[model samples]
Target: MHKTRIGRDGPNVSVLALGGASLGGVYQDVSQGEADAVVQAALDAGINLIDVAPYYGLTRAETALGAALKGVPRSDFVLMTKVGRYGDKTWNFSREATLRSLDESRARLGVDYIDVLQCHDIEHGDRRQLIEEALPTLRDLKGQGAIGRIGITGYDLSVLEDVATTEQVDTVMAYCTYSLQDRRLAGVAQRLGRSGVAVFNASPLGMGLLTSKGPPDWHPGHPSVWAAAAEAARRCEALGVDLSFVALQFALQTAAANGIVSTVVGMSKPSNLDRNIEALTTPIDPAVLTAVEAALAPVRDKGWDVLPGGGGKAGK
Candidate 1:
């Protein structure tokens, strides 16, 4: 396990962060006990950062994470969660709602204060209002010692750039935006890096497309999953490297990516955690990188109908 600096001047954190979305039951159905076990495994593996959101399984994920952190010392790990979206699928950035959301998250995670509190999925026009309303609330929370740092999570590079340039957010959790398949945020990462905002690259596997297993036909809501898998398969064949390993390594090796933050990919079994951990440590060759880029040229040229900020459309 390696550690990376969070913000330019922030605390050190594990190079790989455990994403709590899967623990809440979006990608695969996982029970509380199973989720807790997964969290425990991540901790044992020396992972320190865990990212979750209220939008994931409507707070179920946070609750499961809370249960998992019961015995762990608060100082040993960095806990992060998001506001903006509620369990009922509504986006609210009101002052009251933001404060209430933090309080609820603290209660659910059983933490005195969150290490990082982010605004979830803020986009185009919504960015200004969210900043105006939500950011002030978060700043107040930081003042009150309710959170250690502030952040915003979404796919919009411009908004993130604005936030990173203007605000004092310690981190930015940007998902599926700057993977090998999508490089829209490459410049954003550089800008934020210079600005001292830690950038956590989320969905590094493109939501399971870059794994060894080919994308299934029936994966709900994620049409790009299949396309990404096919592209990864072609790359694997050309590069003579396992697709899953390449995907994971590509993210880890990306110049703009500070660290890879992804859910414990458990579509099939628990052993997948070991496999992912192995991929993180495995060394990749330069020839393999060239082959992968060549194989992915077509998909890259096609340009996925990705959201402007890098998130897929709703129900995509």
Candidate 2:
């Protein structure tokens, strides 16, 4: 894995960062052994960035990741986690809540300091509260050496842009926005880059929509979008290729070309890490990619405003 500087003057991180969602069993049941293996594999492979959040599995991710990283030298990876949005509908961005969340996360992750402390899903919290209370509190923590940098993550690009441009943020993470079916985040990442805000592209698989198994039933994409993804997956399978490989390849390549710093994906086991590593190292077949893109054209750039399982609108 190759490393790049985050923001204009932030820490250097690998381009293919490992996400902690799978460690928490977000997609399926994962054993403690699997979590340990994946974390070690990522570190050995030079993947220096590991992203997680308290909301992922309701603090399970942080707990699992903390155990996985127990013996490993902390300097081996850049640890990142988020505040607010503790559960499906729980959101608190107040000053006191933010501080308490940090302490709880630190204890859960067994870390003395975090590399990047982000405001998770800012669009879900009161916008004024985030700008007026949460963000300022993070800055204070940074000054005190509890956190290294400040960042924000959300599903909506406009809200991410609004906060990143107006606030003193070092990075912005937008999930499912820069995948094969959607390229909206590329433009937003470029715009944010101008201001020295490093952009992270999470869920390059479109939260499972691009996978061969198809998205989870809770995915909020429109019916048409799901149909198109299903068709694309069929075509890929017919051609004896994995749709996820093409999606990951396209996302990593396109993100790099557009100035995006990293692409985060969930990997709970070593086999999962191996497949993703292959996607990063292998050369994409132009003909196969062309076919996949054509199959996905019907829903290109289409998305929903609501989070997964929220039954949000089909179009933004």
Candidate 3:
């Protein structure tokens, strides 16, 4: 278990984070006991950060996480959850809504203060409203010690770019654009790093596309994702390094990626978790890194959208 700082100056967190989306039933159904076990396993493994959202399982994930952390000291780990619209659903960041959202999340997670409270999916037209009205309320909550820090999560670099300019935002949990396949977040990372804002690289595995199993084609949003991932895997095979290793290591190895937050790999069983943990521990050779870059060259040349920022969509 390796550790890294959340921001250039924020508190230290595990190099790998535990993404709570799976526990919330994004990929597959999970029992409450099973979700708690997953959280316990992550904690036992020294993972310090657990990120979840109200959008995931419609708040079920937070409830499960709260149950898992009940006996543990609050100071032992960092807990993060998001507020804002999710999917086709609409949510306003009105002061009342902000208060309600935080209260519900806090009550569900059984925490007095959240380690990180992010605005989820700022691409909605109501983003400006969140910044103007909702942010002040969030800051007020921060003043009253309701949350440790305020952050925002989104799939578009441009949205992040807008959020980065705001003074109220302390952290940004940008999506997969920062990974090896999609380097779109390179500029955003550099910019946010200079501004003293912490950046959490979510979807480092491109929603599991970079893994050994590759991306799935069952969802409407995953067509290009699967294609890009398949191409990368083929290239990795040609270059003689495990494709999954390439995907995992590529994101971890980036200099711009200082915190190296959890890549958020989903699992249907404990064995999958074991395999992912094993992959994290495996040392990636320098030669493999170089080869992965070479393997991605064709996709780079083809000019297909590789990152979420550049119109590379995510699966629903």
The candidate with the higher TM-score, 2 or 3, is 2
* Candidate 1 lDDT, 190-240, residue by residue in tens: 677776777777776666556667544433313444555576577677656
TM-score of 2: 0.96
Give, for candidate 1, the lowest lDDT window spanning 10 residues: 260-269
Off by over 4 Å in 2: 306-316
| Cα TM-score of candidate 1 | 0.85
The residue-level lDDT of candidate 2 at 34 comes to 88
Question: 278 in model 1: Cα distance from truth in Å?
Answer: 1.3
**Best candidate per TM-score, number?**
2
Between which residue pairs do clashes occur in model 3?
17-262
Q: Compute each candidate's TM-score over C-alphas.
A: 0.85, 0.96, 0.85
Put down candidate 3 lDDT per residue, 140-188, tens digits, no spaces: 8888888878888777777777876765488887776666667776667
**For model 2, how does the per-residue alpha-carbon lDDT over 77-176 read when each residue is reduced to its tens digit?**
8999999888777788999999999999999989899999999988888888999999999999999999999999998899899989889699999998
Rate residue 138 of model 2 by lDDT: 93
